[model samples]
Target chain A: MIDLYPTRGGDEPRFIDRQDPVVYGTAEDGPIDAGTLAGFDRDGFLTIERLIEPEEVERYRAEMRRLGRDMRGDERVVTEKGSDEVRSIFEVHRVSEVFAELVRDPRVAGRARQILGSEVYVHQSRVNYKPGFRGRDFYWHSDFETWHAEDGMPRMRAVSISIALTENHATNGGLMIMPGSHRTFVSCPGETPPDHYKHSLKDQEIGVPDEDSLTALAGKHGIELFTGPAGSATMFDCNCMHGSNGNITPFPRSNVFIVFNSVENACAEPFAAPSRRPEFIASRDFTPVL
Target chain B: MIDLYPTRGGDEPRFIDRQDPVVYGTAEDGPIDAGTLAGFDRDGFLTIERLIEPEEVERYRAEMRRLGRDMRGDERVVTEKGSDEVRSIFEVHRVSEVFAELVRDPRVAGRARQILGSEVYVHQSRVNYKPGFRGRDFYWHSDFETWHAEDGMPRMRAVSISIALTENHATNGGLMIMPGSHRTFVSCPGETPPDHYKHSLKDQEIGVPDEDSLTALAGKHGIELFTGPAGSATMFDCNCMHGSNGNITPFPRSNVFIVFNSVENACAEPFAAPSRRPEFIASRDFTPVL
Candidate 1:
């Protein structure tokens, strides 16, 4: 079998052309029509102004607060390094019913199924709680690189949806994805140590794309900062080069992040890592949404 | 590899002793404890008094009403034979967010995971709406028989959870399962037609255990009728000889039914049928619940 989009192997990180098609589904398969499907295929990402209503968004925001407050002791709750601030709550949907309902929402899961051209499962879900001043910056990286090397994802057949719980302003650690950057798969240089997710979830160091590769990508495809009101959402390809700055502003930036992987593309064994990460970080469940 | 639980090809119906373990998980795997797990293994099914709270039950009751009213035109809504009254709403979770949340609830999904020893997906889901006076009886048969013959489910590695939206009384067509009958695999005699589900969902005539086989099983293992208050639930093995009677009483019996199949035990090509059923009745999607 041919292994497309190989990563986390070489001494120097290299960029390879993506082998898989960007959009997998047709107009008749799901909610996405031909035009929108074509746009997503070209851009590698699509943003919506209001994927959820105000009342619904408020519910998720409330759940995020409760998860941050009540689940601090849970191992799935990753805290910011050197502080008590909750950095992220992995598998948020499992812990909170409000967030669980959001995952089942047709507006969310339906779109993922439409884009993936098949039934999809939640590969990972987290509430990225970036407090006003304490939130640290997430460096530039391709999610597929980490997923492939550490979690044993066989291909770039996953897509991530980030639903903003708070207003994502340009200055307050909003996501910044390079346009057309998803076409290239950047093989990161690293060895994924066993149980690396324990430290990496708090602060990722390994499996990061090298500076030269990042610079070249940034130069080729200009960075696009996602700024929108609460309830706004963005769906991006798994291999897209993306990251966000630290929130120095008073407005806290928080988003409900969910990754959807095709049922056909279930993880096998870790391609480069010594072992697989915990299910809360990189899920092994392959049940499709009903 | 040995086909442990084989079915749907013999001229005469016969029972084979179960080769798979009844309870696949230990206490560490999920919510079901040692004693409870053992109890489920002894009997083919287990009943919970308050699987969900009264309020949660009401929400499902409301959703059932909404689905019956609104989704009557949808192809997934199966009607009672010789009547316009809605019989069952197949793929109810996909059509309603409220029912969708119920499927994701750990109380529901966790128990399935606990019993199956692995991540599970919704093999099939429906809101069985047996209306008063007009409802018809479901013939005695094991779900795995039809699933194997028509849907290509290879083993009894699946379980069905029925949560009462309305109070389930003994006279109101409550589910009746033969205790210890799950240990026997009745090889159903018949060829499932190409579009068997179109008729079977409304009224199944094929892939049913013959009267002689059913009589022998009923004589050996005694029938137990499930009667419980609203919010009460039952989890039963896929191969259990079970069926419900017609509701002649004024009280209507409605329950949210969901089937959880182990991701590893996904369906393949049909074992006996001309073709596989549609996704609504026999789901091809094997994405596990988060």
Candidate 2:
């Protein structure tokens, strides 16, 4: 049986210690990092804290945010309706030096290569800033919902890395996740009743009570809250149960969400959000920003 | 601006009417229907009510449940750790006539075709039976979290269809959806604090008023609960915000969720699920079950 972190309440939540810096430059010869890969296979989520230097984090955060704001204001960009409030910045690898550097970060990409077991490619990139007071709190959901097979392939693979610019904690509405929730794929919920809090589905229910119950259950199940200082990052399975509460902190909670996938698995289409034009791939000879 | 139906609290969500039924009669015409296509684009989801007959629903549900029970007994079919639940019954799709029929349902295929605007194929098929009080509730989240692209194509195209065999209602625990929530791709919230609910990312302090607060914000934005009669189903954009409440009812809330995509946009490799085998194809000619 795989060893897992004991649940706070009785639940067997999967947890792995953040990757150690000493192992950052470890040789990749035989058998991928067993511990990290096993943790990922079991928990469907893993974290490599301080994947990048503090200086690089600050640079990427500042420049990306600026670029994000600029793209959001561009009128030529036909923002999809209903998406006006939320900024959808794309293809930063081309425009931002910071992004370019980070995408090729050896530490990040190397680990990704080991885990993915394929030739990785930058599938898509974006920066989302949920501004305080006015920022939106994303509901609970998964990421695999949009992908479909085109060339007869059956499965899709993706890895998402989020770099926190601001400290992520309960006060700031850091992420709240359910342990081992990725094991199942649940159908999307439809509308809710007036007393939505009292609302329940055939399989489950959600409200203050349900939330509290799940929270308690999560604790009992060993689900852990991922809190970290700015520059620290966490990587979890795309199917993992994760979402953040509203950022109740005075400052904005900002993060750069970078998603990568095997080139064979990602689409060749241009970034769908800000632009319909395909993203440019650096020639094989060109050096990656990293 | 897109025309929207007049909505009332507790009333069934409205659907844009189509002059023609989205149907597929030929292989060359593609799979998804126009109505399904248009609905998915506008609402981020659509449903082909009664795509399968009642008898089919019953047949598939009973057989799959029996198979699942048998699998569980033999311990060959792995149940998600911590919970004695098997998420999707993909293998059943191979053996069950009902599942195979639904997977090849022209209505569904046609809609997927329209959204993807290309030839399409089935990515996976399974029975999602949220059993009695024991069933777990999936949190609000998006589908793109895990999907990756393939051979330069996007990871997904079109919508996911769930054909319900049993009545999905508040009593039985139907689906709860947040409309217009798909447009925003919010960052994954890491670990959250218990008191985080009291605070808003916009506001840093705890004890925020319940009125017009973030939780209330979702309500003001309003959530749509999908409660439909048996044989009715719903489909939505992969990015939409959705989650279900638990089965407070005594009976099992069951449905078959069949996912399809534009053949061009699916991942080169299927995401690692029980159904990830490359030979698994839901198309009629591709791999028809006797």
In order, what is each prediction's RMSD in angstroms?
27.0, 24.1
Residue B113 of model 2 has an lDDT of: 57
Global local distance difference test of model 1: 0.83
* Best candidate (score: TM-score): 1
Q: Give the TM-score of candidate 2.
A: 0.38
Question: What's each prediction's TM-score?
Answer: 0.50, 0.38
lDDT tens per residue, model 2, B141-237: 4443223210111333435677787777443346655665555433232222343322221122211122222343354345566767778888776
In Å, residue B114's CA in model 1 sits off its true spot by 77
Question: Global lDDT for candidate 2?
Answer: 0.48
Rate residue B265 of model 2 by lDDT. Answer: 46
Q: How would you encode candidate 1's per-residue C-alpha lDDT over B64-172 as one tens digit per residue?
A: 8877888768999888999888988898778888888889999999999999999999999998888864466776778988888778888889999999888875445
Query: Positional deviation of A248 in candidate 2, in angstroms?
Result: 18
Instruction: State the lDDT of candidate 1 residue by residue for A231-286, as single tens digits.
Output: 99999999888876554334588999999999989998888889888999889889
